[model samples]
Target: MTDTLTVKSQRRHLHPAALRIMHWTNAIAMILLIGSGWKIYNDEVLFGWLHFPDWITLGLYAQHGLQWHFFAMWVLMVNGLCYIAYGFYTGRFRRKMLPIWPRAVIADIKAALTFKLAHDDITHYNAVQKTLYVGVILVIVLQVITGWAIWKPVQLSALVNLFYDFQGARLAHFLGMTAIVLFLVVHVALALLVPKTIGAMITGGPKVTADPDTDREPLPSPAE
Candidate 1:
């Protein structure tokens, strides 16, 4: 009998280092902001179910919460700014973030709702993913705006006035936080649903199979 060797071709995608840094940084910042924000809100009555003592004294006072909130906001803002700059400079934003056609987005949304893989030929984000990604980015920007409206009311009074009042800004900030929480829940659920996706992000590459019958091609690695 003759011995045979098999060669497997794989595709690389994602920038592991960049992704790791951004992911962990964002995660930490979000956690800090949420915790501190909750503490501050507990000082008043936003919802009955969310109640905490006005003075916890466990290194989580309202004043301390404000400090942590601002600190974490800066971290998220700076990191996000850098990520955006890199995306534009490297042209990845154009490739990955530019909205696909409405028909394509609708198709992807239908496929996702039906739990099917929509595009076999496309390797990058599907239309639905692009829309969600863009939506999350806009949400984050809104968070910054509302956050500033609360943080520096005197300096940003004019901007805050657009929203109506400091109370309105507070409401906007709370809503933004809630949206982020919901997004995170869905994102994490999807990650659990798609194990390969988690692997791709971690390994910076995707496993591929070669077959003459299949229409899908290997995904390309993130540009150097």
Candidate 2:
């Protein structure tokens, strides 16, 4: 017989139903908002060469794009609020997403940079992931605030004033969207790097196999 031994992988329930629903809803809303927002941004292209083409935009014109953006924004806002509420209700904020301490984040960052970072569990997030998740929530809030201010500078005078001016709010909104796009890239890459992660998001669990790398512990291998 060969020296290598074969064993069946173990499956664990990772994302609950509510979590999956919220995750997908947020994703769809973000995609729509970004597409329409890009169309609107093209109306007054700050940098002429940086505009998105007509084919990829949600709407061909600013007025139409604004309509789509407003619709998506409301959905994103409502879904985000629901997700936050569920996280609090189920203690997910404390149990999963809490970054714990400042030093932990620094330590995690160092480990990641040095290629020494390995996950202890598929169900749990590393400090860096937790920190990013928390930061993204703040970014979403900023996007909403800036979006409202830009959409109605005169009507929402008080909110617009928070950013000092309409232009300031517009700049903040643009920057926030950029951060979100970057986060999406990293998020998708990491999901692909790890097996069954996306499947877990869709189906509530991932089939975890033995971790062959010795630098880190195995992923809970069951006895053969």
Candidate 3:
């Protein structure tokens, strides 16, 4: 029984099925929200000179965009909540994302700029990734608050007031959207640079061995 339990415990993957599902669900929801959001933004013209072309925007019209935006919002919110819960319950966040130090972040940033940042251990997140992931999570929460404020200024007047007013909330929402977009761009670029990460998300990467002293087997060299 002891040996059987040990073997079963070691049968883990870098990206578990639940995590992959939530990740892809969140990605699709984000894409839908961004496209529909651009459509809605074009209707209001946040910056008079800046407008997203209709061809790229979702929903085809402002009203339809609003509908799609709300639909995607629910999907994202539910999926995000599930992801957060799972992370906490499984201690994944604590293990993979905690104890981020500024010194490490700076070192990692420098290493990244110099093209020396290592990607051998995809199971662990580097400081730069930890910072970005936490920052983007906060941005998503901000988006939700500002979105509510803009959607129903009177009903959610407190949220609107927190941002200063209705237009303030709109501006906040726009900025949050910009942050998410920038994060996505960086995220996609990083995934492309380390293509195995993408494969891991889809296929769960390599099996993770459970041991008190270490987490994984010897990884192949980066050059391989």
Candidate 4:
């Protein structure tokens, strides 16, 4: 019991203040982008059956939506770059999100499905969380590239051609938006299910000594 208490006492703040600030900033930027993007999409939807209603959308019209989208785009870009730099410079990504073995991912998936996944140690990310975080980062990068292609097809003709054409970039951007929305849904659901995570992000949670041994090593292969 004492040993368990000692181990728990080793937990530091789950999120640093800088990260939390960037996180909320990114969240606000994404909300604006999505809302305005929806309004833009409604004007000439790729899918006729999937038009967004005005109440949920950001801007009054497509042109207005474009203005909002552009503003949010710059915000997301600057904030995301800062996040990337901080993650690398602080070794936060390496420490918290690396060594994500496939076996570990599979095990975590099974555990989650069985409702046996552990959240007692909020300090560590499960393999599934790591995978989703990395995937969303890549998806966001793709969204930015595709967005540029759509924004200035004539000036960035090379980029537009890379995606096949203007319509293609639009399609890619829409798909990326869908991916981000799905990630948000899952992320929010998990936060609700594990409420402490939200608190950790908000008030920085309980503080303790830094634990150098916290990082998860790769799971051994089956053959081993």
- TM-score (all chains, Cα) for each model: 0.77, 0.81, 0.91, 0.87
Q: Kindly list the per-residue Cα lDDT of model 4 for residues 1-224, writing each as its tens digit.
A: 46555555445566777889999999999999999999999989899799998999999889999999999999999999999988776667887788799999999999999999999988889999999998999899999999989989999999999889899999999999999999999999999999999999998876745544543222112231
Candidate 1, residue 223: the lDDT equals: 33
**Best candidate according to TM-score:** 3
Which residue pairs in candidate 2 have backbone atoms (N, alpha carbon, C) closer than 3 angstroms, thus clashing? none
- Candidate 3 residue spans exceeding 4 A from truth: 210-224
Q: Candidate 4: TM-score?
A: 0.87
Candidate with more favorable, higher TM-score: 3 or 4: 3
Least well predicted 10-residue stretch by lDDT in candidate 2: 209-218
Candidates' RMSD to native: 7.3, 8.7, 6.0, 7.4
Error of 1 at 33 (Å): 1.2
The segments of candidate 1 whose C-alpha lies over 4 angstroms from its true place after superposition are 1-13, 47-59, 118-123, 207-224
Judge candidate 3 at residue 5 and give its lDDT: 61
Minimum summed lDDT over a 10-residue window in model 1 is located at: 1-10
How should the candidates be ordered by TM-score, best one leading? Answer: 3, 4, 2, 1
Model 4 spans > 4 angstroms off:
1-12, 211-224
List clash counts for every candidate, in order: 1, 0, 0, 0
What is the lDDT of every predicted structure here?
Answer: 0.72, 0.80, 0.87, 0.87
